[model samples]
Target: MAIISLEYYSEVLGMNREVKVIYPEQNKVENFTGKEIPVLYLLHGMSGNENSWINRSGIDRLIRKTNLAIVMPSTDLGFYINTTYGMNYFDAIALELPKVIHNFFPNLSTKREKNFIAGLSMGGYGAFRLALGTNTFSYAASLSGVLTFNGMEEHFDDNPAYWGGLFGTMENFKGSENEILPLAARFEGERPKLYAWCGKQDLLYSGNEYVANELKKMNYDLTYETADGIHEWYYWTRKIETVFEWLPINYIKEERAF
Candidate 1:
């Protein structure tokens, strides 16, 4: 397996961004198999960057074992959100990043069957948010994600600018006026297979459970787990392996080999 860091200007971001990509190496870089490879969009926690996953976790090896390609992008302190202060992080993640990567490496394709999102902490929040926000993903997993934004007004009401650059108001999250709920209400569209795991001792545990409970009652397919641990890299790294194994690969794009 080989890992490389790439930095380039983004038309969507209007600034430079960095990405860390891990693949089985270019035994043949430009061969263009004409076959689409599944992609895992990995995210990092707050104060972490694109390299955080590769540098700190065994993700590189895991990707090799899974025959999966990992795409990790830097979010800085943006909470993976486009704030009033800067770029549209969500758009970058949902659109531009995938486009750029596919353009640079033809191995990547735009099909939903080959796309997945997974992350830890802040990155976890991002992974789930983007997964729920669009139809581009076939699956998603978050290890301790910030799953709810219904209270962001009271929490950051004074700072309505918290994530303004990407979205003008919190109402945008609610999906619509009749739908007074946030992503929770609008999450069922072609619901991607969801999985989430969190440490029982983690601060975000409650919210994580809230997500699972709500989805459960609504009959949204999901897998939510809690274990004895904290919100540390060790816990997240360990869970990454579990998530890879748990991913719904039984629905692989390839047809039955009989």
Candidate 2:
């Protein structure tokens, strides 16, 4: 597996940006086939760089076992939001970044089943926010995520004005407890598969379970699990490996093809 770091300008955030990419190198791997590999947009928590996944989580190797393209973009302090006064980081990610990647790489499929999103901490929140709000992504996951309302206070404590701007009001955060599932009613997607898990020992456990329980009540197909762990990269790397297994990557079927 070879990792590529891309730097460029983006219209969504309206500034210079960089993203770290992990993919099987067609030049080195015979089976690489130079096809458009599936994409998994992994996000970072607040105050993190695109390098977080590789630098902290060590994802380059584990995913080499699968035919997935991992792209990690850097958003300094934006909290992955389209704020009233802050950069529209979410739009840049959910819309612009995918287009950019698809244009530069071989696209295996544009179907929702081929796309995925996952992250941790603030990125976890953004992951579900996009996976639920947008139709493009099919599979989504969050590790040690802030799964439910940590309350407007903690949300604001990070970026008071930004949170207030996108949501409009703290009240808007209320019904969101019902919105964390990756599936939306009458989903505009292929009814994308959902994956959300957090460490039982993490402080976010309560919130994660809150969203998971709510998803159960909604009759949504959710893969929500709590395990013994903590909120750190030590666990994220391993968790990501499991997430790849949970996703329906065709490589497995092809390997077991009768």
lDDT of 2 by residue, 23-100 (tens): 766654446656657788898987788988887765775655567778888666665666556678778887898888
lDDT of each: 0.74, 0.73
Q: Lowest-scoring 10 consecutive residues by lDDT in candidate 1?
A: 249-258
* Model 2, position 111: C-alpha lDDT score: 68
- In model 1, where do residues sit more than 4 Å from their true spots? 26-34, 149-181, 249-258
Candidate 1: TM-score? 0.82
TM-score for each candidate, following the candidate numbering: 0.82, 0.85
Clashing pairs in 1: none
